[model samples]
Target: MTRTLLLFATILTSTQAQQGFGPLDPTPPAAPIPQILTHMAQQESAFANARDHYTFRQDVTFETLAPDTNQPDGAYHQLTDISFDDAGRRQEHVVFAPANTLQRVTLTEADLDDVAHRLPFILTTPELPDYTLTYLGRQRVDQLDTYVFDCTPREILKDHRSLQVEDHRYFQGRIWLSQQDHQIVLIHGQAVPQDTRPGHENLSPPFTTYYQQIDGKYWFPIYTRADGTLHFPAHADALSQTVHVRTTVRYTDYKRFHATVTLHYGTEVPTTPNPPQP
Candidate 1:
């Protein structure tokens, strides 16, 4: 009878083990998120090959809508001609309205030296972070398996500023990155508040950016669309002294290496004054 009892106890213990009710834990360690971001950064950093000088042409369209306006009211169309050197330094950014009509032309040479330092604000800088990556989750964009992540602010001041009682100024939206190359194929998120007002303090706009591979190395945005509300003081109402203004910007029709040009990069560039004609 004692032997029979021992056998029954052993059988019960085995049954529990088989049913996953044993003493051992089952959860596995999660993959490090920073490591994934680092991997993405490494891939993007080596994308573009170093060249002596390269130029790209871009078309820009900007529109702003007033309060309660069904359509965009303020519209502007312009073209940008940018040149970069082998060291990935911007030499010139000639902005024209149409037919080479010079609206604003920047020469890295003397007399216009100050503006050259600010080129990174407009053109891509070699050392800049490829993207702000936050692990979103596994999702599909365009029927392809992708990992969703949030692009955080790579700039310090831009990231620390809060939007409202509980909001982050930078990286408040979500992005979908392709699992294959870890490239940001689609981005959907809200824009950081541009102004501080009573009801408008925490306002955020919806922004989307789409990336496509260019020259097989670089992944640049082929298309982008963003719309957001800008708040303004209500003229007549004091208690409710703010109205939402809609604004949008879109980019299309990209052309690469339109012209062969020479680039000179340094703090000082040789200036060539207009040669006096006889």
Candidate 2:
């Protein structure tokens, strides 16, 4: 018989604990940050790439509050199982998806992309040459001490699908590294939010992602959250329209997975079979 185990609880991140220290309040980075940042970026890239082999569950929720009254207006939630197919492709099966008032507003694909890939920026060795780094001193996360760094993309990248907007050009944000292991424990930042190209105005709320040690080796993203104002061009009614929103996603149920194989011998052998010698 096989047993099922629960590894960790769902992570609900709090920004209040993160605001305790500024990047340069007490002191600045020690020195030699450029080389250190590059090395750490490579490690982070390897870490993110390794997660495709594991299967986990994600719980995501979105809520909007009335700007006039600050009351909850609408909300939607879903629980999905993220796994890989035999061909080595990622798949998300929605275990739960509840209907809500989110459909009333126009949510473009770009808006969804902003929340998905744009916010959780991961710096790798390949992408390092395109950006510059700065030391942001130290910060305390829970009981662990971490080194902070500011990352800014040097040049603007052209959009492949459509005309480029101001926000789609660069990546500007901060990353937290564990002082002991140099693994990225947290990241707080977003894409440039200065898009003003007519109907293509791209606005993203600054979000923070927290990573936890898995199997005492690598740190993986376990929680992500953002609470900020969302402006849509389709907004007409002030009361019914939602400009302020709270989005939180929790990842849990981390279980190791590997393909199972059965070996066939020439014949079945019993453990307690009589000896061949007579």
Give one digit per residue, the lDDT tens place, for model 1 in 59-99: 54445554575555555445666566556775545476643
* Model 1 TM-score relative to the real fold: 0.53
Question: Against the correct fold, how does model 2 do in TM-score?
Answer: 0.71
Could you give candidate 2's per-residue lDDT for residues 1-278 as a string of tens digits? 12222222212234444555433443655546665676687787776567667888878777777777987688878798987665647688899988866643444556556544555456667777877677768878676778877877665333333435633444578888887767788888766644644455556567888888986877877888988886655434333223787778887887877786666799785578678996
State the C-alpha lDDT per candidate. 0.46, 0.68
CA shift of 225, model 1, Å:
0.9
For model 2, the superposed segments whose C-alpha errors exceed 4 Å read 1-31, 84-89, 156-171, 232-242, 260-278
Query: How far does residue 154 in candidate 2 sit from its true spot (Å)?
Result: 2.4
Clashing pairs in 1: 51-86, 52-86, 132-151, 136-148
